[model samples]
Target: MKRFVGFVKKEFYHIFRDRRSLFILFGMPIVQVMLFGFAITNEINNVDIAILDHSKDASTKEIIEKISASKYFSVKDYLDNENEIETAFKKGKIKAVLNFEKDFSKKLQTENQATIQILTDATDPNTANTISNYTGAILQNYQELINKDIVTPYQINTQTQLFYNKELKSVFMFVPGVMTIILMLVSAMMTSISITREKELGTMEILLVSPLKPLQVIIGKVVPYIFLSVINAIIIILLSIFIFKMPIAGNYFLLAAETILFIINALSLGILISTVSASQQTAMMISLMGLMLPVILLSGFIFPITSMPLPLQVISNIIPAKWFIIILKGIMLKGVGLAYLWKETLILIGMTLFFIAISVKKYKTRLE
Candidate 1:
């Protein structure tokens, strides 16, 4: 009994001493709880919305004031004409637009009814639907508030126009997200484990001793994986197109180029992981545990980043998957070209270069 108790104490001490174990036991749970608690919400707050009030009448102004005053939405832009709506959505800032037709006040008072069109970017159907519902609820409450003294109550008709996805198909949203997650996990996990395996088996030293330069060795190690990863990307694209009937609105060549860039970004990240990890198990664990949650939650795959708290929203900027997912949605749903997508493309390129530079520096340090 004494010997067994001593062994248990030793095991506990070993666990407490290892920083990685301590992090896994205590730090990870807290982080996961916080992420899940804050990021897993469906409710949207302070969502940016644009206004196009052709009437500019008292009724229109009051309705606009009510919308802007709500905790759910902020009036970001007030457009002069309908031509600006397309440009607004392409910029990816405004989520919904409130268009008050001309004669809103006249029609509401004389005919006892008026129309307000809610144009929502339905690239995310769930969010679009939620916005429509919330806006409708607000209008309903306003109608009730004003009708208490009038003999004939005024009715506000909202015609919701869902751009990009008329049917509100949930599949349209999930396909791009699934593709992003698959590519990130497969490319990063595989390359990290492959390089770490070489190091574990003592073959990396043999390669270093050869005539090949350090950069050449690293490139050679990742080249085969790149080819394989591209093929995997192609397969996923074809599946999204044929099996799911997903739309590809932008140029195929540009889409292919962006996909290749994201895959390289992921592969370079894997190489950086390999530099720090000493074994295949460690590499795999880091790739799976470290990358999975951030990719799924912080990437804005399912949840709206705008709805999240300020800290998580700021943290999401550093996530490569978040940028790639934006690129995918822009091309696939919005039919946007390079002119509109330049910022996100540049960000991925910068991240890829940074990862490669770090990996090369670490590789040289290992040589010393």
Candidate 2:
């Protein structure tokens, strides 16, 4: 009994002394809890929406005011004409557009009915459906409030039109996100593990002593993985198109180019990870924990970034996966060319360059 107690006490001392162990036991739990609690949410808050008020009447204005007042949505743009709605959605801020039919108040008074066409960007069908439902509920509640004293209750009929994905298919949303995750994880994980494996097996020293320059060796290590990752990306895209029946409305050449760019970005990140990691286990853990969580949580893959807290929203801008997902959705669902997606593309390019620069610096430091 005394021996066992002393051994346990020594183990406790070891745990307290090791910062990594202490962090794994305490810090990780706190981070995981906070991330799960705050990042994982079904409700949408402050979702940006556009309004095209054809009626521009008293009732229409009041309804718009009510929607604006609600915490769930913010009326970001009051579109001047129907043509501007598409442009707004392509710009990626506007999620839905509330188009009130002409003569809304007059129709409510005389016909005792009005129509509101709720056009939603359904690239993310869950959010689009939620927006439609929430908007409809607001209209329904408004109808009830106005009808309490009247003999005939005025009806507000909502015609929900889901753009990009009229059927509200879940696959449309998941395919892009899944593709982003696969490409990111597979490319990053494989590259990091590959480099780390060379180090672990004591072969990296042999390569370093060879005639090949450090940069050349690093590129040699990465290029095969790049080719393999590209093949994997092609397979995924083809499967998504044929097996899942996902549509590719944009240019295939452009898509291939963007996909290769993202692969390079992810590979550069892997190289950075390999530079700091001493072993395959360390590299694997970093790739999986450090990269996977952020990709899923902060990349706007499963949750809307706008719906996340402001701090998280700002942090998400730094995530390369977020920009790639935006690019993919823009090309696949919105069918927008480089004109509409130039900003995101530039952001990815900048990130890739930054990652490569950092990895090269870190690798040289490690070589020293």
Candidate 3:
């Protein structure tokens, strides 16, 4: 018991000695929270739009003013002709173009209706959709304001249909990605660095010769990180639940089991990395350039896997984070059970076993 406690103490000392690294360890989650919560968003604001007003009248001008006054849009240019609209969009002068019909006020007065065309650059589909929605909403509000005193004989109702996620909350997407990053950072990157640090300091030989068996030594080194990784998962879950109001739709036990499986896979991968790396820096480089970058890019964390090129999509199948994210989204957002997630669960388990076995074989081969 004392020896095990000493092993844990030594590991803790090694970790905490580097104040800078320690700061980054805790800061990672906070930074992820702030980044996803504040910066990465689909919400449109302060978007520059171009207007081609043929009416050039008070009512048309008023509509433009209302759109510009709102926090969502900024009317940067008053286009002269239809030709200018294409030029403005092509030159990146505007995201959207609002074209008012020549007889807007006259048509509104005589026929109680007028037409306007909203053309948006659809290169970035999500942003373009949001811009269109914002424009439509502004126009609808303006229509209601002008027609408030004058009620129409007939009524038009708007029915909105939101699939899967009714609220369309960004948290549903960000939270799962945040969990993946935190796990990858804590379990894979840190573990590899820690093991390699011991190797660099020539302390691994001393531990190997001690009373503890090889497996025991490995466990002693890994236990602390496993605890930390699980704690991180819990913290992320709590933050998602309490702060962001994200739902945990699946069984908690199953979620936890899957998280542990992912952590084990990460830790095993780290161990495999440590076996090949000669120094802490090498391990860190491998973890960052090799492990972390793949997790961020190919894992569908920031981008969709389906949207990737065929070869890249095939490559992504081997990335552990990709499956874990699918599992997370299924359980957390979709409320799927083990039956629905059995394939992902099996993939993670297979990966964990494969990494662990390979790491063990390498460790034994080195010892011999």
Candidate 4:
């Protein structure tokens, strides 16, 4: 027990003595959270739009006023013709062009409908789609407001309630994802690199040749990482809760248990990497390129899985971080329990076992 305590103390000394590692371990989580929370966003706002009103009538003028009044769109240019619209788009001054057909008011009064063309630069599909939707919504609202005086025979009123994130704040979604990624990075990548460093320095062989069991050595190496990862998780959660005002709807104990499970899984993966890697550099590169990218891109962290291609969707199934993020979201956002997240929990357990088995096999083979 005294030896174990000394080992832990040595680990702390190593962590504290290395300013770079300490900065990365403590600072990276907060930096990632802030970057993802503020810098990265999917929600569209203040999209620039150009208008080409051929009618210049009361209805067209009113429609333009409605669009300009909307928070989603800012009318950047009043286009004189279709040529000007194209020129404006080419100049990158506007994302969309709204063209009202000739005699729009007259047509609306007589035919009960008027054609308004929404020409958008599809270079960025997401922005284009959002701009189009915003335009359509403004038009619909204008029509509804104008028709409110005359009651229709049938009216369908739709009320949409966006659960979990009422404001559809991207930060709410990103906080849990950032937490998962940071934990994975610090626990798995750092552990792998640190363990491989011992092997590179010829210390691992000495420890293996000693009375210490392979499991003991591995656990000792991982113990510090687990402790650091827990601290990081706590810091991130506290920052999200207090600074960002993010909610923790589920049981705090359950959340901690799930976080520990994810950390264990990540740590096991790190151990597996350390067993396979010949050097610290190799382990670090493998963890960053092989693990981090997939965790960030394919884990449904920033992009929705439904939006990804079929092949990419299939590929994401293998990423343990993906399952961990889903579990976190279920518990944190939806306030779900084990019953709801059992599948993801099972997947994480399976992945951890797979990694541990592989590491054990590899280590034993190396010994022989």
Identify the leading candidate in terms of TM-score: 1
lDDT of candidate 1 over 37-78, digit per residue (tens): 999989999999999999999999998999889999999999
User: Whose lDDT is greatest here?
Assistant: 1
The runs of at least 3 residues in candidate 3 whose Cα sits more than 4 Å from the true structure, single-residue gaps closed, are 1-160, 210-216
Clashing pairs in 3: none
lDDT (CA) for every model shown? 0.92, 0.90, 0.75, 0.75
* Model 4: per-residue Cα lDDT over 290-346, one tens digit each: 688678877867754434545666888998888887777667766767876788889
Candidate order by lDDT, decreasing, is 1, 2, 4, 3
TM for candidate 4 is 0.60
Prediction 1 global C-alpha lDDT: 0.92
Which of candidates 2 and 4 reaches a greater TM-score?
A: 2
All candidates: TM-score = 0.97, 0.96, 0.57, 0.60
Clash totals for all candidate models: 0, 0, 0, 0
RMSD of 1: 1.2
Clashes of 2: 0
Residue 47 alpha-carbon offset, candidate 2, angstroms: 1.0
Q: How far is each candidate from the true structure, as Cα RMSD in Å?
A: 1.2, 1.5, 14.3, 15.5
Candidate 4 segments exceeding 4 Å error: 1-157
